[model samples]
Target: MTIKPIIIIPDPLLRQVSKPVERVDSDLTHLIDDMLDTMYDAPGIGLAAVQVAVPRRLLVIDVSKEGEDKQPLVFINPEIIRSSEDRSVYEEGCLSIPDYYAEVERPATVTVKHLDRLGKEQLTEADGLLATCLQHEIDHLNGVLFIDHISRLKREMVIKKFSKAAKSKVTV
Candidate 1:
């Protein structure tokens, strides 16, 4: 397992919609491992495949607080089958977006369907932080970022800031 460098904003790939995984195999599993490792190393609760430069409808999440058993989840070709009308807000951050974070309002509950790590079908209903995390990562599969939920001016400013930061890092 290895932590791959996250693809940051202004990278066009993050905006491109990810293709669904057609088959689960050793390769896909390895990607899952890498994603898990990356997310943990990121010290993040969730990560999307696009953040790692893999344009696949894949994501890894583990929201268990420290000291709890690590609960890793892999979602392959996941789609939200249901979502509650009630909304909740969370201050969300992305590894791809580095330190920037913003409050994003999303469904308070969601039912998602996907294939698990062992190639088994799994469906889960999540609420609260789990619900927000699920929706945030799912947005990545659709080429949308949490920042997109913010105002247009805010989004543009964030993108420009990140783009400039990226350039500075490149030249340094």
Candidate 2:
């Protein structure tokens, strides 16, 4: 597996809604492996395919703490089947957004249905950090970012910052 370059903020691709994966074939599995490599290299807890410039409904996450055994999960065409009424707040960050983080509120628990890496249908119930991570990544599938959940002023500030950074990168 190779570590793919993650697309940063202000990239229009990040706003594109990802298409569902038709099949979890070998190629798709390989993409998952690459995503895992990229996520680990980014040292992030979760990553979505759209963040890597692949407009597909795929994501990989490993919430394991440092020095602990890695527990990677692949979600293909994931759909949030259920969400708890209780709400929780988590300071969320994205691999695409880099150094910036903000508190976002979402359901404390959720049930997701998706295809596993091996092409098997799977349903997983998640709460706590896992639930937050799932919701964050799922937002990417819908062309939404955690920043979108924040106040418009703050969201515009973040977008402006990234936009400036992107401009500087191009000139350099």
Cα-based lDDT for every prediction: 0.92, 0.94
Q: Cα RMSD to native, each candidate?
A: 1.3, 1.0
Residue 158 alpha-carbon offset, candidate 2, angstroms: 0.5
Tens-digit lDDT track of model 1 for 1-172: 8889988889999898999898999999999999999899988999999999999999999999999999998889889999999999999998888899999899899999998888789999999999999999999999999999999999999999988988888853
Instruction: Write down the TM-score for model 2.
Output: 0.97
- Give candidate 1's error at residue 46 in angstroms: 0.7
Candidate 1, position 61, lDDT: 96
Candidate achieving the largest lDDT:
2
Candidate 2: Cα lDDT at 75 = 94
Of the candidates shown, which would achieve the greatest TM-score relative to the real structure?
2
